[model samples]
Target: MAGRILVLNTGSSSIKYELVDVTTRDRPARGLVERIGEDMGRLTHRAGDGPPYTRERPVPGHGEGLEAMMEAFAAAGPELAPVAVGHRVVHGGTRFTEPVLVDDEVIAAIEELAPLAPLHNPVNLTGIEVARKAFPGVPQVAVFDTAFHRTLPPEAYTYAVPREWGVRRFGFHGTSCAYVSRRAAALLGRDLAELNLIVLHLGNGASATAIAGGRSIDTSMGMTPLEGLVMGTRSGDVDPALAGYLARVDGLDAQQVEHALTHRGGLLALTGTRDMREVRARDDDTACLALDIYTRRIRKYVGAYYALLGRVGAIVFTGGVGEHDAATRAASLARLERLGITVDPALNQMDTTGERAISPSSAEVPVLVIPTDEEWEIARQTHALIS
Candidate 1:
């Protein structure tokens, strides 16, 4: 707890690392290794407040990505000797409800959940294995992205599908949602227990969750990340029969359809691009349609969860697009005036840098934009484990 905590958020093709001073709640250094397992990989490292250090080289795998991160810290400032290494493991299933120290058995459990999250869990375990070897005896903690939603009630999580499939809604982005929703309560000067919040996590992967009395009552993403709002590359929802129809008509297998839904679908499929900023910058018809699809999906969830909550204290927005894109926020909440949700145009349009309420003064439900700090949350949880 006295030393820095190294928080690692490893994706299939990237590694995001931060050296956080737990006591001060400050990040001394942070960097990203992007496009791993490909040619022309890039590493951008930043320390303190200086310019970022950049490198372009081939990163053959996640192991190399970790090595590059270490090299970045060594070459830059702030020697990296972490008290603990916190990894952001995607699918913890029902086994891990909170951050737990990783052991061989835990690693095996994560591997067992791979079928539930084919693209994420396997790669996540790879990061865990490589880090365990690289950092030797350091305490390694698995801070799950799904951990925060473990409080979800049975009715909310159970899917309508046959129970034999052993599938249920295991919400993603729990770390970001947990961090932002708690911060939302703090920002509003209210106790989280008394607050009913609808948290919208919009990024490459998006989800909406209803936090009733500070526990996840319901969420948009179910069973898999592919079940929620439109995402960057994943199709959020589709007709149940579409997969079988594609198999019969187009000679596509179940795996092929799943791959497209997981990889080539969503905003990328609707439009040529997936990033909201890119879509917003374009004035073409396709871009406009994609934006409509994205925001409409968000609006539906807001309305659905609002009904479920009966009384909403706040509608919180976080993640890449939610935190930065004001236009999307305004557009998504525009028609909810009857629900007491209205954003002040001037406040919403302002170039704000931190958390702030954008809802109109007379609005009943406060609409807030909170920047998410998953790395800080991971570091805090890891520190807690050791303490």
Candidate 2:
């Protein structure tokens, strides 16, 4: 129970592993195996103070990638003995409302829910499978991204569509929201159960969640991650008729339309690039329009969630884009002064690498930037299940 917990976040083409000591909050070793199926794959492993152990070679599959990770741990340092392996499984659907110890039945259940998250669950399963072979008998826990939003009220999660289709909102970024929201409560010197929060997790996949008394009352994402705010590549809220229109005129199928919406929409469709930093750096008309579209989506969600929460104690921004992009933080909430949401220009624009408020002291709703630590959350949940 006192040892390290290995957290594995496997993507379509990458595996990000971190060895975390929950008690001391220290990451003894952390690294990535990127471009897994590519001919030129890379593995970068870090342990102590010196340079990270790096490897560049063909990683034919995730199995090979996991083998390489084991090799890195063996060669680098810190014996690869983890108390538990925490897997970040993207969509648990309605079946898994909490972290469950992984087993044959759990793996089958995760596979059954694959249709809900075709891009993520399959790869996440691969990580689990590979880890089981690597560390036999070690407990592996599946920490769901949808678990935190299980607190969503029926009204907030229910869709207006045919109930027979079994479609409704199941928000992502729940893990990040859980961590940041609790940290936000601590920063404010209040209990999480007493605070009303609107958490904006902005990264490749962005979402706005309204947390009332520490419970998710509403969130932007619905049924799938593709329904949230405009993300790096996903088009958040598209007209339902547009896909039908495309099918009729362009001979595109539903899967094709979904694929385009998932991989080629949003900033990529607007500006030919998915990186937000690149979009903000350029002052061209197209880039400016893309920025406007992105921030406008976020601003709309803020207003909508504000109305839902009735009163917000704090608006916490987390994830890569939320923590570092001061311009985005400012632009998203620019003209909301009437709603008691105003960011102090001096504080908002300053470059700081800590959790701090950017809103004016006199503002009714304080706006904060809290960095998310999902790895720690995963490890904690995994530890709770096993120990």
Candidate 3:
């Protein structure tokens, strides 16, 4: 239990694995198997401060991806023995509110939930299966992204749709929110239970969550990840009649429309590039408009969540765009001075790789930039379950 936990986050085309020392809170080894099932695949492994050991080969399947991971561990150092294996299972639905030890029953339950997360759960299960095979006796724990938002109130998670449809808000990024919210409380020198927070997780996949007294009261994502803030490739929110309209005008099916929204929308649809930094670098009108649309959507959500929380102690930003893009940090919250959320321009632009406040010390709501540590959270949960 004191040794290490191997955390696996299996995506459709990538497998991210990390060897974490739970006691030290350090990652001894971490790497990714990217472009699985593609002709050109890459694996990059890093241990300590040295340059990453990388390999390029065709990884035809997740099994091959796991094999490449083992090769990387064996070829690189650290000896690759973990006390427990932690898997990042994206959707837990209503059944799982906390991390659980993986068993045949757990595996079957996860399989049953696959339709809710068609793109994620199967690959996640593939990772679990491979990990079970790779480390036969090691205890495997499933850490759910939806688990942290299980505290969402009935009004926040409930949808107006038919109850028979079984559709409701299932906020994503709970792991990141959990890590950053606790850090935000520490940074503010306040107990989390007393703070009302609006957490914006702005990575490739983004979400805005309102937390009160250390619990999720409301969130942006509803039913699926596509309902949230504008993301790298996924459109945040569309009119409820969009699918029917598309069908009438362009002869598209609901699934096809959903696929397009998930894959070809957001920044990519607006600017032809999914990377925010790339979009920010361009001076073209198209890029400018895309940025406006993106930030406007975010501002709208911030205002909506503000109304929900009534009083926000801090507006915490995490994930890639939230952590690194100072311009975005400034633009997203611009003109909110009436709400006492003012960014200190100099402080916001200052380059630092740690959690720090970007808003003026006297501001009503401290705007913080907290880099999320989801992998470590997964390892911690896994260790807790096995220990």
| Local accuracy of candidate 2 as per-residue lDDT tens digits, 48-109 | 66599999999998778888999999899778899899999999989999999999999999
TM per candidate comes to 0.97, 0.96, 0.96
RMSD of each: 1.2, 1.6, 1.5
Give model 2's TM-score versus the native structure: 0.96
Worst 10 residues of 2 by lDDT: 9-18
List the candidate 2 regions with Cα displacement exceeding 4 Å: 35-40, 58-61
Error of model 2, residue 124, in angstroms: 0.6
lDDT (0 to 1) per candidate: 0.90, 0.91, 0.91
- Cα distance off (Å), candidate 1, residue 289: 0.8
Query: 37 in model 2: Cα distance from truth in Å?
Result: 4.9
Model 1 per-residue lDDT tens digits across residues 1-387: 588998999986889889998898778899999999987799999998989999999999888888888888888867887889999999888888999999999999999999888888887888889889878999999999889899889898888888798888889898898899889999999999999999999999999999997899899988777897999999897898999999999999999999999989998898877778888999999988888889999999999999999999999999989999999999888789888999999999999869999987778999999999999999988998899
Cα lDDT of model 3 by residue, 290-345, tens digit: 99988888888899989898999999989889999998888899999998889999
Ranking by TM-score: 1, 3, 2
